[model samples]
Target: MRSAFLIAPLLMMLSACAGEPTRMGASTKLVEAEEAILMPPPGSFSVAGITQKRFSNGLQQEIFLSTTSAVPGQNVVQMRLYGTRNDLRYRDDHLRFRTVTEAGIDAEMRGTLPGIPMKRSPYLVQNDYGAFGYAFGRPSPTELCMYAWQQLRTPEGEKPPFAGFGAVQIRVRICETGASERKLLAFMYGYSIIGAVDDMRWNPYGPPGPVSDRLGHSGNPIYPPEMTAGAEPDAARPVAVARPARRAVQPVAEPVPTALPGAERVVVPSPVRASSAAQPAANVAPASSAGGTIVPSPACVGANAATAAACP
Candidate 1:
């Protein structure tokens, strides 16, 4: 009875553009199909399957565990330990001291959780690595303090150039990430998941500035310059690399028809152009009946780009 987690669906996921409502029965069928397909598999471990054993004599132990399934193409391993932090920000000192490590290895931590004594191992990371950590903290009648984190791994041992971000062919034994954010077991449900992209240590020093350059923006005032205080200005900042929009566009190579077929046929097709900078006020998305916020697709910003309020 140590955890209380739930399977969460991607409720707020970006929706495909809607030209019209699906036929009445289609939406209902979609829900039933998802219900049949999205249930959690059996024997899934919530906390990386490892737990620390502490005896009355103060004997400490670590265990390697497994989840119901590890995602395909994603590297994962689950191990449990014993420890706690005063709060959530993942203080370096706290992580360094609490995480169990062999004498010489320095483990990096990405984020913290409440009941589960978990922190991402950022210390073991490669250049351009990434991770996500979430904690289900102290809950109350009307409030559940949920904390989430996403971290990028920094290169630690300095592999070859291609190894910097190339394919490493890792054999991920297990992963506990589920289909929904609300998929929690009634008992032993308190837990977290920290996913690393390349490495575990999050110290990406570039990209934000380059992103600003791409956005043709000076930087948002909300995130003060001091936020990047120690960041080497020459090095890039990583915050600006939010996911770019991806849309499916089809090519129409056929010509258009004209009324005067015998004499001549008029053929014309619209051109595709990159979009310009969006107005600051244009960020809000319309609310769906399910209360989901929908955002616009990413359009390229080029001097000769086309301007469309929304992309379908």
Candidate 2:
């Protein structure tokens, strides 16, 4: 009985390390735990929109876009529910540097989570954090991870596969204006821990788990300040450019020719021939060949016509 009692506490400790804390909906418990240490986001910002995506493995990804009075663009924060396959190959730190450098992040900060191992990618550079490319153990109710990445000083147009890590990640970019490195880091820390906790609480596996009645509410939806103005917001949206129309073709006319100057005029008459009636009239009587004697015609009108001078 004593052995079983000791085993129970040991099992619970391991489970808590592997699972979400007792207060599922919030990361406060995690922060309270030594594993996480960060201040929560103050009333300065609120969630503007939530984009939720369900993957092929029945896992969910949620992106929370928040608007702050101190930031220019809406902060893009994401969280991937559950985790990835265990057998996937994790790239070396040298490869990780090469990858994110190619994607535009020039500098990186490396560290580990309290309970996770040192051999894995638990590091969060400038603005990147979350399940950093490795999966935690499965079936433990609260085991969730997230990541964030941003290329602040670098110019746009870096070939993707951004030099960061994670199998499933949530990225919250650092705002351009009205944002300091501290706030950006705070946001990264807040979301990587709390944002992931929020996602897991909202869409948990199997039976509905315990939720914080207080933190579960994601406040009222809001839009960016630029959109709240009374003008059309098409400038933010993409538009298609129309192509030009083609012109119709007109046909050419042929020219008429006149006779050339100084050319000789030639007249060619058509040949004429006597008809059958005229032939019979001219040869009314047949004449003897080389002799003055008259010859009779087979179709003679009168027998006297056949004789020479006496018949005519």
Candidate with top lDDT is 2
The numbered model that scores best in TM-score is 2
Candidate 2 C-alpha lDDT tens digits along 1-312:
999999999999988867323433321111122222122266434555444433332223333344432422344453443322222123211211123442232122122123322122354443233222322211123322222443222223321234212223233433333444354445544533443232322222123237756554676345577676456667675678898988878777677787798655443222221112234345544433442433333333253433322222
Candidate 1 lDDT over 27-120, as tens digits, reads 1111221212111234443223222322221112222333343222211332221132222222233222232233212122112222323323
TM-score for each prediction? 0.16, 0.25
| TM-score attained by model 2 | 0.25
Candidate 2, residue 32: lDDT: 23
